[model samples]
Target: MTAVAAGTALLLTGCGLGGAPATAPVDTGGKVEGTITFQTMQLSPTFDDYLNATIDAFEAKYPGTTVKWTDIPSNAAARKVSADAIAGTLPDVMDLDTGTLAPLGRKGLTVDMATAAGDVKDSYVATAWQSFAFGGTGAAALPWYLNTPVLISNKAVLGKAGLGSSPDPTGYDELLTRSAQIAKATGVAGFQPTETGFANSLLTVGVPLVDETATKAVVNTPEAVAFVTKLAELYRSGGIPKDSVSAKERSEIETFSEGKTAYLESGGSRLKIIKENSPAVFGSVAVGKPLGDAAKRTWVVAHGLAVPTKSGNLPTAVAFAKFLTSAENQLALAKVSSVFPSTTASLNDPFFAVGDGDLTAAARRIAATGLRDGRTTVKPPAADAEYGATLWSAVQPAILGDVAPAQALGDAEAKLTKILQERQK
Candidate 1:
């Protein structure tokens, strides 16, 4: 999940095992009066005033209702949520990403937002709304904030490598070609394919992670083999870093900041870090659309509000969630933070359509446009870390030249098939 304020990238660890069976849908009863505990992840101190004011407005709008707000540190949030869920003490309204909410929805710990508040379905972006649907359950959360990746390149590095200051590659193949040119000319890696564990790399290149039924893995196709083979070749030619094949997002950013790599693909909020840490590289930065297949789709990270089915006041909890994600409230939050709003009306605000000609502003504008076609990339059933790790572990050996790409993908397919079967059973 991406942090709303800092755009800090966090890995989606796999879900927990063993939970009580599904419960009946939450009954709101049309009375929005009661006290409900609301929990958010790492939005304090900086966003305290905005959140408090929002809460105050919510309280004033619906008299006799109170919101008790609590903020959890990002590092401890998942652990705390898991513990609370096991204890049946989850907050009535909680902040979560689809990655975190899906598992809970599978266990019926979360309210089906579509059933509880389906009338507002058309208010959100179709893709953002659908992201929360999982395990045959309707939408499990109300979409809040969102972000998408943009390609940030250091023009100085590109110019030094004879690629000119404004090098633009339309897709992955051209990106690889440019990467090789930069490495050959400047002896610096041109790109660092940050190990996402997820099959984002494959997805960008038009490879599907699974079949339509999602009961079988289909990533062992010829296109997948060809892409893996290219990655192996890039690694052998010093066009990409050795450690990068297993490195995290922080390492990728560090390499680009230090001028060891020419391009960094990340959220627009990350430009703040680059400007703070490496003004020299930041000065020469150019923003571009994310490189991908014909769909031109980019990866989106969304944060949403989920109401636990066991909430003491389902009606009030659900009402608060709706109020918090309202177009007006979401746009207000977007004005004060780096995150984008998940609501369709919020996105249409004039703020997203303009840029100030600065790199960061340009990135925001580009990212906003990207979000129109944006998606979470990997959908449920295969969205968990275990599934991603299975793909990565099988393909890593191929990237390291320890096995042929086809053979590695075959192994991955078999493993994924078995895992999916087990999950279905």
Candidate 2:
């Protein structure tokens, strides 16, 4: 899938239709003895062994309960979930993204995680838990794993450009300077920042998309205009890809994988693909801090599991969900894939801190520590997709040199303000 900005594709696990969270109260003293179907988001084959082992462990703990696991294709998963919701046949437990889960929560189809998870709640990272909890009504899903963005460098290419192996630019200004240097020497794009849209730029610089109350657009400040304008200048100077203004993640990924760019801001998970498809490039890989205007935060995304409020085996389903996200189970999954666990216990495991002195391990360690200070770049209203699209459309022209940055941002702010106001109604 084309990775947009950090927060555009978020999902929220939620309660049923009445704006009231559905209760999935744990029956700790009761017996769990029914079959519960657990649907996953395209996690089969690659994670088959680890998942099967986790399921086996859960079943062993509760002899009479059976977990019927199902894996859905990523493209079909959301639609299938929606269809199932309409038909009242959503699996007992299912994994969802923030975007898919948010609407479901608003409809109150999913049960509240606060009532479902028992004492196991304290084990999770507070931010991860709060993110799924929406408005602090308690989480509706258990954060399973995270994918945080990191700065990756092709050392060989960067060395040719006179930049260090692990280049750490302080902000967009330094980023542009370094990128222009690389582009001048190598004749390739210098920095392939995740032009997932305007949000990506704003959030990386510690600028909130909206004001504290989220009622109006606050991105028209002088700092914002300068940032956006600089990006356009970088584009013009060949510091970024020519198509960057309209480029999606695939283009950036392709450019970086083919070593056409010196620096890439991508999720830590991309390391696996590079290792497999571009071994030569992988050998010279270097991990560095995420480039931004701020020091404390970066962009992060996660995958989590949620349960339907109408499940026939509520207790068993909730129990299994907890089991799947348990520190041990999460670690098991992390051991096999590029995923990083969300649980504090899992993160504290020695394996996470132990690096083998290689770029892959170094990147993973940087990402793991960064997740502690990370957040979704933007948290748009429920009508985020519509408004986000509008905002991006309005701003792209400026970034592409079609309009002045201040004018384009002003136009986007006006449209977004109206959109937010209308959505509140």
TM-score, each model?
A: 0.89, 0.84
Q: Tens digit of lDDT per residue, candidate 2, span 74-96?
A: 76765566567767899998887
What would the per-residue lDDT of candidate 1 be over residues 143-168, giving only the tens digit for each residue? 89887778889898888888874558
Best by lDDT: 1
> Which lDDT value does model 2 have at 365?
75
Which stretches in model 2 have alpha-carbon errors above 4 Å?
A: 1-29, 165-167, 194-198, 210-223, 246-250, 292-294, 372-391, 413-425
Winning model by TM-score: 1
Query: Looking at candidate 2, what is the lDDT of residue 223?
Result: 75
- Cα deviation of 228, candidate 2, in Å: 1.0
Error of 1 at 296 (Å): 3.5
lDDT of each: 0.77, 0.69
